[model samples]
Target: MNFEEIKSDENNYLMHTYGRFNAALVSGKGAKAVDVNGKEYIDFTSGIGVNSLGYCDDGWVKAVTEQAGKIQHMSNLYYSPVQIETAKKLCELSGADKVLFCNSGAEANECAIKIARKYSFDKYGDGRNKILTLVNSFHGRTVTTLAATGQEVFHNFFFPFTEGFVYAQANDTDDFKAHIDESVCAVLIELIQGEGGVVPLEPEFVKTVADVCAEKDILLMVDEVQTGVSRTGQFLCCQNYGIKPNVITLAKGLAGGLPIGACLCSKELANVFTPGTHGTTFGGNPIACAAALEVLNRVSTDEFLNEVRQKGKYIIEKLSTFPNVKKTRSAGMLIGILTEKDNAKEVAAKCVERGLLVLTAKNLIRLLPPLTITYEEIDKGLEILKSVMEE
Candidate 1:
């Protein structure tokens, strides 16, 4: 169908939840996409970091296709070898003892919250179920995860949010300490606040939080929904900080482009979730698990991770040279460019007009290019971005 027809049909049938772009992408390959009108675009956003291996990745397709032919899905009541294999790979790579699969980042985070609260209640009883999260953090859109998010903006329109959540200033050790007490069961954080404008927490502050959580026996939960699965040039972003979180939530790039979420727990909290305590219908769908297995195999490698780091560095350096760029902040392929003028959204629209797809996060232009993007694609995207910024 044509772009206008698709838009009209969507407006008639679908709820207006997203403020969508004008482009109607019909097909894509690697880091390039084509609109219905045959306009080509460099896809730097990578479907908001979901298409980790870019469009139609050969290995990812093969795994998913093979699994679909065998068994698309099996009830959790029955054992699934593919699911078990995916879990094994996740545990082996992430240093987590066990994993509980779900269908999205929000569900993964919800599971983490449940495990943390239940673990505390199981041992210390009630009153210690409160979870502290850093300010400006974005967890998920679910009522429970929405409350878990620290941003006040997301708190509105949803009344009587889930209780037992408190906010602490990010990277402020004193502020974090002031909010901590016996009532706190866990401290959830994102090492790199992706939706919060790609902000990276201070290493010292992270270490202090980890130390305090250890001293108080509070569970330290890292929300890696955006930064995990080699997006940050490591198997997990916590590895760069040299700290081990009791629980870590992952999604987005985990299954290349498929829907899958995982809540991985350390040995201490591994058995916290009993069989009947938690579950999901599509938690470990065989096809999704097969795609995730392929993603893990390709990304959890020293060579691939190093290339991601180098590509990130190259993009950062090139962005810094742009005249309109005020500053650049990033960790691997997850990047944010602050413009000298507060026109991030306008600039992003202009980029799309000029055959490049970018995203706007607050006042910064965000980029999450494919991890396997070639240098030529990066150069092309950068050229388009520079041209738009120069205008």
Candidate 2:
């Protein structure tokens, strides 16, 4: 079908949740996508950071295809080697004790919330379940996760959001401390606020929070959903902070474009969920695990990670030279181009029209190009972006 037909069907049949761009991508490989009309685009968004290895990655496709051919899915009651291997790899790489697989970033964060509450309840009995999240931080879209999100905008529409969540200003040590008390069980944070703006939390503030959480025995949960799996030039963004969180939530590029989310907890909180306490039907499906394994095999390497850091630097340097760019906030491939005119939304739309896919966070032009995107692809995308900014 043509783009118009697809758009008509989408508008008529589907809910109008997303204000989608005017394009119908049909196929892609390595930082490039082709529309139904055969117009090619340099993919800077990478499906919002889900395509870590770029479109149709050879190894990732092979692993997922082979696993689907064998067993697409199985109940959690049954043990699968692929699932075990994926968990093991995650634990080994992130230094977490155990992992609970899920289907999306929201589910993974929900798991973390449950674990934090359970751990606190198991030890302190009750009334110590309030979680503190930074303001302007985006957790997920579910009821509980939405409640956990610190943005007041999300608090609306969802009537009476799940209780036990409090907001603290990001990078404000005093504000975070003021919110913390005997009732607080956990402090969930994103080292680099992705959806909020690609803004990195201050190193000193992070250190202070870590120290306070440790001293008070409050669980420190890092939501690496958008920054994990080498997107931030490290296995986990928390690693860059030189601190190990009590709980870590991962998704997005975990399976290199497949649906998979993982919540990893330290050894102390590993056994908080005892079988019936928590579960998901498709949590540990063999196919998703297989794809995750392939992603780990390729992304968790010094060579690949170094290249990611370099690419991020190069992108930032180029964006700095752009006429409309005022500044940039970046961690590895996750980048936000702050426009001088504060017209990121308009700039993003113009880029999409000119054959370059991009994203927007708040009012900044966000870019999460695939880690494996070539220099040539980067140049092409940036050229288009530069021209759009010039206009």
User: What TM-score, computed on C-alpha atoms, does each candidate reach?
Assistant: 0.99, 0.99
**Alpha carbon RMSD to native, model 1:** 0.7
Tens-place lDDT per residue, model 2, 1-391, is 8889999999999999999999999999999999999999999999999999999999889999999999998899988999999999999999999999999999999999999999999999989999999999999999999999999899898787899999999988999989999999999999999999888999999999999999999999999999999999998999899999999999999998889999999999988999799999988789989999999999999999999999999999998888988889999999998999999989888888899999999989999999999999999999999999997
Give me the displacement of residue 149 in model 1, in angstroms.
0.6
| Model 1, C-alpha of 234: deviation from truth (Å) | 0.9
lDDT (tens digit, per residue) of candidate 1 on 8-75? 99899999999888899988999999999999999999899999999989998899999999999889
TM-score of 1: 0.99
Candidate 2: residue 259 lDDT (0-100): 91
Candidate 2 off by > 4 Å: none
lDDT at position 310, candidate 1: 98
Clashing pairs in 1: none
Instruction: Enumerate clash totals for all models, in the order shown.
Output: 0, 0
